[model samples]
Target: AQPRRWPLEKHEYKRYGRQLIMPEVGLHGQLRLKNARVLIVGVGGLGCPAAAYLAGAGVGTLGLMDGDTVEESNLHRQIAHSTARVDMNKTQSAMEYLQSLNPHVNYNRHEFHLTPQKAIQIFEQYDLVLDCTDHPTSRYLISDACILTGKTLVSASALKTEGQLIVLNNPPRPPGDALGGPCYRCIFPKPPPAESVLSCGEGGILGPVVGVMGVLQALEAIKVLTARAQRPANGGDWSTNGATSEAAPKATLLMFSTYNTPQFRSVRLRSRRADCAACSAQSTISRQSLTSGSLDYVAFCGATAPINLL
Candidate 1:
């Protein structure tokens, strides 16, 4: 006789007994977390902590994508890597650490930059995307890909002593809804003049600051995936219940300054411009038309412009 098929066992609730006790995240929430899949696009300062926490929290599957290798300088902030993995790929190092944290959680790693062609293909496989990249170009590219694919994007950014986090679900617009909330492009219609901005290499960052921001990023991802109850009437166009009524869903821009006096402030995002180069057909179509030739995003991001040399 053939051996009897064994019944699938339920998740080890005892392992997450404390989380189960929380009113916000009880048994049901834990189950939801176990079923969710999240994609983190970078394994640097921000991604390291966010990915660590999410994996520890029992996210069903964690996807880590990064093309860089660990460096001696990165050890100060990127807590996921160690001196032993100094020259290893960021994704591999992150995966090894996450696996050790929670062996039950499924971990996937991609040692490649998030190119346009790879964005849609990879994003389609996951339920949510986390923009943990440091550069503005990668953030915008991920945002555009999320919009086109209709995926929830939990976007965050950290530099120096501050950071910002936002959830963009691409809520459905009502018929003839002319007042659309900003996309990433609405806030930054174009990449800033390359010379105007400095990288983390030029401007130093605090290790702990990135840690706090990354934790918040992971928290937001959990809230979004578990469908947590929202706070009452914050007076924002975006619905607290994650619903899109007649009003356009708002985009929030938060700033943090940690050098002199630590502070967090929310900046109002302007309405979307119909003529935005990134959103407008004039810009996207022209770029998409270059199928026969290669497109250099670094140049498109203005990083390779003449002014960037200065």
Candidate 2:
């Protein structure tokens, strides 16, 4: 079969000439990337880097979601926007930057906060979803939506000088497999109570640290989309060292100190709790079952207290 021609324009060739020369990302990979669609939630420190890299890499469609507007404080880390863009909707600013980065890539903006319904609706249209939000509530919500929709989620988080990344549901399991890789709920079962952990607003963060992790998130998303990396082993377990096992899913958490040294630790995530309000009812939690009251993920992860007075 003749390889499909990539409708490349002159400017695209000139712009991506270096990348186009690489064996891994030659015309074929570029084309594949150009045809792919990725949804990114949040346009803060982390989302800025991830979205920029993905757009520059030739992802065909980019969807950005964020209800917040740019603020003066964001100038330190949210690199996609500028001092001029302060007070602009983050989604709008990000979309403009992405378009400027690659006109061949289509940019979609959702200038709205993510809700359970919104997460499911928009996420279903994309090949992959990127979580770059700082709030645990948003993270769990995005995770659950992705799991329920069977969409691949590239989840990343950062604070102070540390960050973490993971790929979920790339080669997702069938609904009832006990050994299936753990869902985000399996890793965090509930959302933390508000104000338990210091918000980025209260706690300062190093800008470049988020840049590093966000790029990694984009790289993982690309690897999953292009079949470059094997899906994480069942039970959410993966090893950079190539070790394989049947244990519970393990998350690689990396902590970075101001000295620039990074400490790596792994945690084996439990599979669904039989009592877990999210995944316990079925092999997978139904969309309707994911209401705010269905799970206390924040408390489950020991990140925060329940919001209720109880």
Candidate 3:
């Protein structure tokens, strides 16, 4: 018989006892989550909650990247930062809180802006990417880099009383089959015009709206990393053995509104486009092209006002 997938040490069993007993997250699934590596961009509203849960769940490696420093104003929605951490780097602040929550996980602090030149190199080191930044430039930059690196991306955003979420570029089943899900470029090939974009700082996001979406982002990440079904050695039929095949990950847009009447709308997105510049066979973006400074994601996405947290 195969060895137990997640051979929980005594401390691990004690720490994750509740989760380990869940039917969906039995030994195998928990092991997958433990070995997963996730890179989260921006330690603001979305990143804060998402990171907190992912850390609490015992993901093996968590990479936190942010260029901003904590501000008094960020406390309302950026839950990871505290009064004492004001003026501290956002990545460092979040890391400090997350380590306190679960020191068993490894945390990486990237204390700078995620420029196109550095995006691919950094992205390549992680198994998955989460887009938590509030700027259009960073959105396009993260999406394109994920496409180039073949990493699945769980992207979410919140503004005012609403939030949006999506999963992109999941690995196809059977491994080398076909690309599983559409990438970010597959849905919004172009970013919104500079003046049309709004962020939490400018539009005033509801604290709970971002918190819910961030938790959902973490949920999606867990689903992606740990949904593989395993079978026992009794040679039973997969279906009859109570091990149903997992559904293929789809590209969908989740729109959530917390106005007077809370509402949600999930729309299935289109499949990968053959002409997509980032993930297509004839695409112009490549490792060489990226290294040579050929992609102008910031300009392509249009110029936006500098984010102000005041």
On TM-score, the leading prediction is 3
Tens-digit lDDT string for candidate 1 (238-260): 54474545555566666666764
Off by over 4 Å in 2: 1-14, 178-180, 193-195, 228-251, 263-284, 290-310
Error of 1 at 286 (Å): 10
- The lDDT per prediction is 0.72, 0.72, 0.81
| Candidate 1 segments exceeding 4 Å error | 1-11, 170-181, 228-245, 260-262, 270-296, 305-310
Candidate 3 off by > 4 Å: 1-6, 172-178, 229-250, 260-262, 304-310
Q: What is the Cα-based TM-score of model 3? A: 0.88
Worst 10 residues of 1 by lDDT: 169-178
- Per-residue lDDT over 1-310 for candidate 3, one digit per residue giving the tens place of the 0 to 100 score: 9886647767888887788897767777788888889999989999999999999888999999988999999999889999999999999999889989999999998999887778889998998999998877777678778877878889999888889999888763212223456667668777888889776767898899999999999999988887764433344344555654445445789999986454899888776666766766656667666666677666676665444211
Residue 122 Cα positional deviation in candidate 3, in Å, after optimal superposition: 1.2
Error of 1 at 234 (Å): 11
Question: What tens digits encode model 2's per-residue C-alpha lDDT throughout 106-156?
Answer: 888888887664566677788788998887767777777777777767888
Best by lDDT: 3
Candidate 2 local accuracy as lDDT?
0.72
Ordered by lDDT, highest first, the candidates read: 3, 1, 2
Any idea what lDDT model 3 has?
0.81
